[model samples]
Target chain A: MKLLKLIFKNSLRHKLRSSLTIIGIAIAIIAFGLLRTVVTVWNSGVDAASANRLITRQAVSFIFPLPASYRAKIASVPGVKEIGAANWFGGVYKDKSNFFAHMAVDDNYFVVYPEFIVPKDEMEEYKKNRNACIIGSQTAKQYNIKLGDQVVLEGDIYPGRWEFNVKGIYTPRDQNTDATQMLFHYEYLNETMLQQSPGRANSVGWYIVQIEDPNNSASVSKQIDALFMNSTAETKTETEKAFTQGFISASGAIITSMNFMSFAIIGIIMLVLANTMIMAARERTREYAVFKTLGFSAKHLTGLILGESLLISFLGGGVGLFLLYPLIEGFERAMPKGFFPYFYVEPITIILAVTATLLVGVLSSVFPIHRALNTKIVDGFRHVG
Target chain B: MADIIQVNNLSKSYWRNSLEIPVLSELSLNVNEGEFLALMGPSGSGKTTLLNIIAGIDRPTNGSVSVSGTDISKLNESALAKWRSSNVGFVFQFYNLIPVLTAFENVELPLLLTKLNKSERKKHVETALNIVGLGDRIYHYPKQLSGGQEQRVAIARAIVTDPLLLVADEPTGDLDKNSADEILTLMERLNKEFNKTIVMVTHDPHAASRASSLLHLDKGVLSTNGQSH
Candidate 1:
């Protein structure tokens, strides 16, 4: 215990160097945490997908639409329990400065995905009113829109201002729900489209089909795709998770690059920590010799040095985690809903970071501590500093 | 008095690349129990090397170093270290008190090797500090103390563990006359009162005069320099 106290005091001999090393470690930990969170955020969409549901969209791209008449044909499939259609409304709130996802979805969407918890009475109101809309929890908070309030959105793709009455606020059951989306009656959008361009209103963007047996999702997906293989809008049907995973795969290079950058940060941390430990060891050569002369064994001296290194890593990681916690919370609040439904530091990331920091501490100290232990007591005594 | 330290034809050589330089050649000496012995030699006469070997801080190139009847030369480096901790107290020229520790803590260092609890260690440290006349300055760090005070604290640390031998190399080499006198007086008092066996290496005649016996080293040969005073 006395030796431990001495080791601790010795570490403070060079305050500036110790503090700078700790700060360097903290920066690396924070950067690594942020990168891991970004990767997790990208995968969050797939995690939110429902196992029992499948989505059918244009085979080559999601930009193309299929004939609305295809919905009846898909509903008739044996494994499919229900079907609902939703289209990207491509609208913004007020002006271009305000940005949020606006989707035109049918009343059956609320039933097709029951994971979205909606107030029972509000569901009936949404189905009855043609101009009513359902907003995600975050979107409602952002616009301060209540159930009875009215909101107006400007359309870029369809043109002109669109008005709707807020009918309900939907909360996500888990990480998969998009909280930044604004879902309104598709009939309202189709009626306007029919008045302007009758041909466009006759088509739908995508179909969401829930299955009776979750295990048959893949077979049903194949059946749905075969049904439209010869049609004008060739379809691709897959489980909801596979569709979301496909979207995430589009940014494959970006994720790979971020992972490589994290490794680079770890390397930098090791170099910086090793350098700091070297300087510390150099400064204490004579003191170590004194300890040696006073009866401190080589292992005792090494423990003193390694103890300092471990303390530095433990402290830096703690402070970095403290800073990261609030930043992740604030980010979850500020980011558009549904985008990063769960932007958080998972237990695995925390555990890995802590383990990595400890490894860094041990690795950084090994060279210096070995050199110190190998130094002859006489030579150490002769050292001026 | 019986011999406490025996050096048998000890030799030490330093290596510089392919060259070998002899520092001490076939040196032999003996120190008795409860003796105050001073070692004197010219600048390159290997007085420090001889002291280091006797303290088991360094090994001889040839021959054996028997301290308190144990062959320290035959012990492994780690075993020698443990033996040195229990058997030797080292006082360096510049009063090498750990700069960051307080005077009391410096004295407490050797006691860390002992099986004593904290209270017992503290008691031993306080007693050691009191013996050196620095009981009031126990909490002061090396930088806060004067040259004489620092040496006194070093003396306290050296005697804290009550080792079999106390080896001081130029204990007053860096101090002025008054401080050096105070240091010498403290060493003399420790020798006389505590019955400690002290071997001090010094070039200072005034410092050497305080010892009960003196050995002068010239070109690695030892001869007795009588203590008349």
Candidate 2:
């Protein structure tokens, strides 16, 4: 313990150098943590997907819609318990920059997703009104929306101005669930399309099937896909998790690059720490000689060097993590509501950061410790520094 | 008087580009217990090398150095270090104190190698510092102390472990004339009062005059006849 105290004092001998090195290490760790969090947030959708739910979309592309009649056939599948349908309603709220996810979902959409919590009275009002819409709590708070307000959506795909009455505000029960989506009655859109453009009616972007047992989701998905084989709009059915993962895989290279960047940051930290420790050891050549002359063993001197390195790295990592929490909270507050709703550093991420710092500490000191111990006592005494 | 240090034909050399450069060659010496012996030599006379070998900080290339009856030249590096911790104390010309440590901590350094607990180590460090008349300056760092005070702290550090022999290399070479005389007086007291066997290497005639006996080395050879001044 006294040796550790001496090591600590020696590390602080050059106060500015040690402080700058520690700050550099802390910055690297923060960068690493941010990169990992980006990857985690990107995959959060897939992580939150319900295991018992399956999504059936057009086999060719999600942009292509399937016939709405597939919902009834999908509901007849043996293990399927409930079914819901939704169409991609590409709309602009007030300006192009004010973007939020707006989907046309069937009345049973809320039934299939019980994780979206809504007040009983508001849900009843939504069921009674054909033009009623339900907005997520986060979106509602952003636009300062309330019940009975008219929300006008300028359609981009259907090429018309659609208006609806806001009837409910829903909050997600799960942390990973996106809480910035707006869902409305699909019948309203279908009926309007039937009156204005008959060819676009009776089409849905996807069908959500809730299964009786989560374990049978894979077989049920296969059965549903087989039923739609060779149809006008062939359906591809998969677990919701797989469906979400497919969306994320569209940017697989970006995710891979992010993972690489995280590791690269740690490597950079190791080099910086190694350089600092080497410089310190070199400067203390004479001091090490003094210790040797005072009867300190080579093992004791090596331990002192390694202990100093480890202490610096651990302190830097701790400071980095301490600074990261508030930075992440600020980032969460600054980002668009739905863009990264779950931007949080997980406990596992903290563990990884600490482990990486410790490894960097140990590995960085190895060469310096060897150099210190290999110094001959006679030569050390002659060293001016 | 029983000899505390016995050197038999000790040799030390360095290898530079496959050529052996002899620093100390076939040197023999002995010092009685409680005696203050000074080694005076010109540059390249191997005075420091002989001191290092005698203190167990360096190994002899060919012969043996027995201090307090242990053949230190035959001991391995690790064993030599352990033996030195309990048996030898070293003082250097520039004080060689760790700049970051206070005087008390510096003196406490050698005691850390022993089985002494914290309080025991503190007690020994205080006693050594008080003996050197730097008890009030125990909390001062090396930079905060003057040359004489730093050297006194170094001396306190040397004796804190209560080693059998004290080896000094040019102990007053960097001090002013008055500080050098003060350090010499302190060394004289440590020898006469505490019965420490002193082997000091120096080029200063005044420093050599303070020793009970003096020997001179030239061209890696020690003169047989020593003189007392």
Candidate 3:
């Protein structure tokens, strides 16, 4: 206990150096947490996907559409229960500044994926009205989309502006399923696009499939793709998770680079801590010698130095985590729509940061402790001051 | 006189790559309990080496050193350190008190190695500080005190554990004449009143004069000065 007290006191010998080292550790940990959260949020779509669901999109490009009649064939496939067709309808609200993920989904969207729950009365009203729309709770809050408000969407592909009455607001049943999308009637886009290309009006961006048995999803997906092998829009069927993962796969190299960069950040933290610990240890050479001359063993001296390093680094890590939570939360609230859905430091990230700080503490103390222990008693005496 | 520290065939050497330089060659000595002895020699006479060996801070190349019937030479590095913490207290020439510690904290350092409780350790430190007449200055840091007061605190620290052997290596080397005299008087009183077994190394004849006995060394061999009170 006394040894610990001495170690604590000695660590505070150079307040500026100690504080700076801690701040450095804190900054490193905060950066590590943010990077890990970025990776997590990036993969969140895949992580939160339901196992029983499958998506069939254009084989070569999602920009191409599948014939809308294929949805009826998919719904009749053995073990298949329900199906809905939806298209990515890129739109801006008010102006380009207010952007969000706007999709034209079928009225059967509720039956295709039951995870997206809407109030019974709202769903009935939405089904009764052709121009009714559904917005995610988060999106509704962001744009103040009340149940009666008319939302005007500026379209990029349909060649005409569209308007819909907000009929319902939905919240996610799970964390991975983001409640930030704007879903409306697929007939509205089909009708508008038919005016431009009358033959393509009977097409959709993708088919969402729900099966009776989740374990047979892979077999069913293979069967579905085989059925479309000779069709004009050759379909690629995949689990919802794989489909979401495909979206992120486009930026795989960038995410990999970020992973490498985070490791580099840890390495830099180690170096800075090592430098500070070495400096502190060197400055206390005479003091350590005195300790040795007073009959302190090599192990005792080692403990003293390492204890100081661990204490400083751990304290810094704690401070870094403290700053991270509020900063990320504030940014989460102010985040532009569809940029980062869920930004947070997970439990795993916290554990990783703490473990990294401990490793840095031990590594940083190694050289200084070695230098201190190797000093001869007589040499220590000679340098007395 | 019963010998408290016994050395036999003691020798120490330094190696510079291929060359072996002997500091002390096949020398031996014995000191009885409660004896105040001064070791004096010219530069390079190996007085400091001899003191270091007896204090267990350095190992003899070839020899055995037994203090209070324990063969310190047979103990490993860690065991020897533990033994020395309980057996020896050192007062260095420059008043080598740790600058960051207060007088009381300095005195409490060696006591940390003991199993004594905190209150008991405090009592021992207070008694030791009072012995050096610096009890009131226990809270003063080493830098705040004068040279004499600092040395007195060093003395207090050395004797705080009441070690059987108190080793002084030129304890008054850095002081003025009056301060040196005061330190010498304090040493005399410690010898007469506390009956501490003191072995001091000094080049100052005036300091040596206060010792009950003096041993002179030249060329690493001890020769009795035959001067005693």
Candidate 4:
């Protein structure tokens, strides 16, 4: 305990240097935490996917639509319970920068996804009107939309200005599930498309199938795909989680880059910490010699050096984590609805940051402590400083 | 009196780029218990080397150094360090007190190795500092103290563990004339009143005069024929 006190005091010998090093370490930790959070948020889509749900889309590409007739065939598959379909509207509000997810979903979409909670009256109101729609709570908040407001969507794909009444605002039952999407009846889009372009009618972007047993998802998915074998629009059926994972893998390079960036920040912090420790050890050569002359063992001196290094690292890590908590809260609040809605720093991420900081502290001190202990007492005494 | 330090044909050498530079030859000496022995020599005459060898801080290239009946020359580096901690004290020329620590804390350093608790360590440190007339300045840092006061704090630190021998390498070399005299006087008092065996290396004649006997080293040869004043 006495040795620890001495080590603490010694670390403060060069006040400016220690403070600067700690600040540098804290900044690196902040960068590391932010990057890890980005990777976590990106993978959250897959993490929050329901086990009992399967998504069927065009085998060629998601951009190509599947004939809505495939929905009945998917529901007839042995393990399937219920089915719903949606079509991507690709609409922008006011400008492209004010973009949010807009989709045309089947009237029975809530039956397949029971987690999107809407008030009973609002759900009834939505079913009563053809041009009525439900927006996520996050989307509603973003545009200051209320239960009786009119929302105008300038369609990018259907290429028409569509107007709808905001009938309700839905929230997610699970916090990890996104609540930033705008959902409307697919029949309205189908009828409008039939009048504007006849060929695009009776088509959907994907089919969501809720299965009776999650364990039979694989076989059921295979059975559903076989129904559309060699058709004009072949279908690919997979669990909802796998579908989300497929989207993640489609942008594999970006996620991989984020992972690399997280590790790179740790490396940079290690270098900075190592440099600081080495310089401190170099300046205390004579002091170490004094300790040796007073009968301090080489091991004791090494412990002192390591203790000082660990102290600096732990302090920096704590401060960095403290700063990160509020930053993550602010970031989540500022993010657009439906875009990375569940972005948060997980407990595992905090554990990893602490572990990395400790490893950096121990590893960085090894070389300097070894060098300090190896200096002969006689020679160390000769060093005036 | 029984001998506290017995040196038999001690030698020390350094290698500079594969060229051997001999610091001390096979010089032999003995210091009795409760005696003040001063080593006087010119620069590069190996006075400090011999002093270090006697204090068990350095191993001799040849010959054995027995302090308090233990052959320190044959001991391993770790064992020598332990032996030095409990049996020897060091006072360097520039005081060598940790600048960040108070005088009391500096004196308490050697006692940290012992199993004594904090209060016990504080008691021992206070007694040692009071003996050196720095009890009132226990909380003062090294930079806050004058040269003489710093050297007194160093003395307190050296004796806090109550070692068998106190080894000083020019303890007053960095002090002014009055401060040097005061440090020499303190050493004299420690030797006479506390019966502490002391081995000091210095070039100052006045510093050497305070010892019971004087030994001169010239080119690694020791001549104990110089009479003490």
Taking all chains together, each candidate's TM-score versus the true structure is 0.91, 0.92, 0.93, 0.92
Give TM-scores of the second chain, every candidate.
0.96, 0.96, 0.96, 0.97
Residue A340 of candidate 3: its Cα lDDT?
Answer: 70
Clashes of each: 4, 0, 0, 0
DockQ of each: 0.72, 0.77, 0.61, 0.79
lDDT of 3 by residue, A177-243 (tens): 6777888899877887788779779899998898889999989998999888987889999999999
User: CA shift at A80, candidate 3, in angstroms?
Assistant: 3.2
Candidate 2 C-alpha lDDT tens digits along A1-385: 7698798897788889889888988998898888888898898888889999999999999999999888888889899999999888989999876767899999889999998999999999999999999998888887899999999999989889999999999999987777878899999999999999999999999999999999998899899999989878888998999999998897999999999999999998899999999998988888898888777887798789989999899889989999998888787777765567557897778889999999999999998888889989888877765
* Per-residue accuracy of model 2 over B84-198 as CA lDDT, tens digit each: 8888888999888888889999999988888899888889999999999998998999999999999999999899888899999999999999999999999999999999999
Give the per-residue lDDT of model 1 (tens digit) for B109-148.
8998889999999999999999989999999999999999
Best by DockQ: 4
Fraction of native contacts, model 1: 0.79
lDDT of 4 at B215: 92
Q: Rate the local accuracy (lDDT) of all candidates.
A: 0.86, 0.89, 0.86, 0.89
Please give the lDDT score at residue A292 for candidate 2. 82
Number of the candidate with higher lDDT, 1 or 2: 2
The prediction achieving the highest TM-score against the true structure is 3
CA displacement after TM-score superposition, residue A46 of candidate 3 (Å): 2.5
